[model samples]
Target: MIYTVTLNPSIDYVVYPDEPIQLGQLNRISKHHKYPGGKGINVSRILSELAIESTALGFVGGFTGDFLKQQLQDRAVSTAFVEVEEDTRINVKIKGESETEINGAGPHITPEKQAELVSKFRQLKQGDIVVLAGSKPSGLPGDFYQQLIRLITEKGASFIIDTTGDELMQSLEHQPFLIKPNRDELEELYETVIDSKEAVVQYGRDLLNKGARHVIVSMGKDGAMLFTHEGIYHGSAKPGRLVNSVGAGDSMVAGFTGTFEQTKDIKEAFRYSLACGSATAFSEDLAVKEDIEKVLQTITIKQWEE
Candidate 1:
């Protein structure tokens, strides 16, 4: 079974305005939509749309949290989130001239609440896949992901980590199965500009040297490069006008993990990852199986066997 961990999840309230948004004034919304959001939650949603079953684990509370849980169930994704003391957050995304975001801080997770989450992690078996994604909540320590990875690795489970900055840096010591960091993140890690594919691939390799078994350096539109302990692989992004890039990376992680679980083929997995991202980029929501397959056919995966 595949398990996804979202430490901080929310109800994404996406508001579309008919006209430009005015700052410090009441803006009228033309349309609105809500989705079960947070990086790992998005991964589970996309995985379900691709016909892969995954259990979403996280902390949730209040009526808003109930709504978010129902949203996932409505999409046929299994969830086992712990009930916390505070209400879940509602992230507002006002879409008009450009996107404007106002994010809320959810409930503080106490030691007992965190222990409950760790207990859930203990249920994973040796062969199961676990994905730890998104940010650490305000109340949590920076080493949260590292601690989770250490516990999950001890269970002999394969893992995928999708986060940036120090949290991501610290988790590398656990040697996660996969880590997906976008171009900007790559730059931050190396503290240099990545202007060429060689530079990106080299930096991804550097992460592997530091203990990550597999590294995927994603370049929006330009495509993504995958580096394993064995070799490197490349897949190009599909040609299309991006409607929404919000869940694209999470979709890519889902696609890659889902395909890797089924085939254990790295290149094919990269194709699926690129396809899923492109599909999500071309739509307002996450990519479905049909859209992902269509993009999959157009993506070519080349291997750098050396």
Candidate 2:
């Protein structure tokens, strides 16, 4: 079974203005939306679009948490979130001339609450896939994910991390099954500018050497690269007008994980990853299966040649 963990989930409130924003004045919207927002939750939603079943496990509480749970249930994604004391957060995104965002900090996850989450983690068994993504809530230990990696590794269950910076690097020593780092996050990891394709491949290799079994780097319109122990492969992004990019990366993670779980084909996984991301990028919201299929028709994957 596939399980996704979102430490700090949220409700993304996105608004589109009919006109430009006026300073400190009420702005009417042409349209608006609210969706359960968090990396792992987004992955589960996208996976459902592909007809894959996954259980979403994370911390949720209060009315916002209840709403997030209902949203996922309405989308047919199974969930088993740990209820917390604090309210879940709300992130507002106002889209007008440019995007403006105001994010709320979710409830403080106390150590007791953290232990409750870890207790749930104990249920995972061998051959299960667990996705650990997004940021840590306030008061949680920095090595939280790393510790989970160790526990999951000991259980013979493989896990993937969709995070950046220290949270990512700290978990590397546990040898995560995969890590999805975009080009910018890659640059941040190595602390330098990634100027060329060759550099991208090399930096991916560096992560491979450290501990990651597979390193997939998403390069937006330029497409994405997949570095496995076997060989390097590339997947091209399908061309489309950008609508909203909020869920693109999460879609990529879902696409890769769900496809790979079904077929165990690395190349095919890379293809789906690109197509799924492109699909979400071309839509106002998360892409459905049909959208993904449309983009898939335009994607072409090939082994990278040195």
Candidate 3:
């Protein structure tokens, strides 16, 4: 079984206008839709599209929380959320001539609630995969994921994390199953400009040396690269117009995890992950199984001769 953790989730309200807006003039919304928004939630949704079953674990509360869980349930995704004291927040995304967004600061997570989440995670059996995804809510300790990584890895369950900065660097000591960082994130981690592919592979290998079993560097349209003990593999993205870049990385993580869980082949997982990410990038929403499949045929993975 695979489990995904969303420390902070939100109801993403997307609105669209048919015409241009004028300063000091009111604009009317032509269309609007709401979707469950969070890095972990996106992963679970993608996994479901691939016909994989996984549990979503997080803290949700109030009417917005209810809506998030219902949205997941409607898509046939199972959720195990801790009810909290405050309502879950809403994120508003406006799409007109240009895309605009206003994100929310979700409700505070109490220590007691945090501990309960930890307890829930303790039940995972060996060989189960848990994805500790997204940013932490306010008031949580900086080492929150560090602690979770330690706990889950100690219990014999491998974990994947999608975060950067000190939090990610700290968790490396626990040896996460995988870490997916973008080009900018890589620069942030190493605090230097990566001027060439050699430097990219070198810094990535440095993370592997720091105890990360595998590291995936997402390079947008240029494609993504996978680094592991076996060897380095690169997957070039299929040509497509970018409809939405949101959730692309999460989709990549889900695709890699889902395929690896079933096939345990790093190469196959690398190919599938690029397809999943490109599929999402080519669509307004997270990629469906069909979209991912179409992109898979165009995926080409090459060995990096470093």
TM-score of 3: 0.97
The true-versus-predicted C-alpha distance at residue 200 of model 3, in Å, is 1.1
What are the RMSDs of all candidates, in order?
1.4, 1.2, 1.2
Candidate 2 stretches with Cα past 4 Å from truth are none
Using all chains and alpha carbons, the TM-scores for the candidates as numbered come to 0.96, 0.97, 0.97
Candidate 1, residues 1-306: lDDT per residue as tens digits? 889999999988999987788779887876999888899999999889888899999899999989988988888889999999899999998887688899998889998998888888788789899999988788887677776787888899988999888878887888887899999988987789999887887788889999898888889888888998778988886589889989899998998898899889877788888999999999888887788888888897788644
lDDT of 2 by residue, 96-210 (tens): 7789999988899888888888888788899899999998888888889987888898889999999999889988888888899999999999999998889999999989999
- The C-alpha stretches of model 3 lying farther than 4 A from their native spots are 21-25
Cα deviation at 64, candidate 2, in Å, is 1.1
Q: Rate the local accuracy (lDDT) of all candidates.
A: 0.87, 0.91, 0.90
- In candidate 3, where is summed lDDT lowest over 10 consecutive residues? 16-25
Q: lDDT value for candidate 3?
A: 0.90
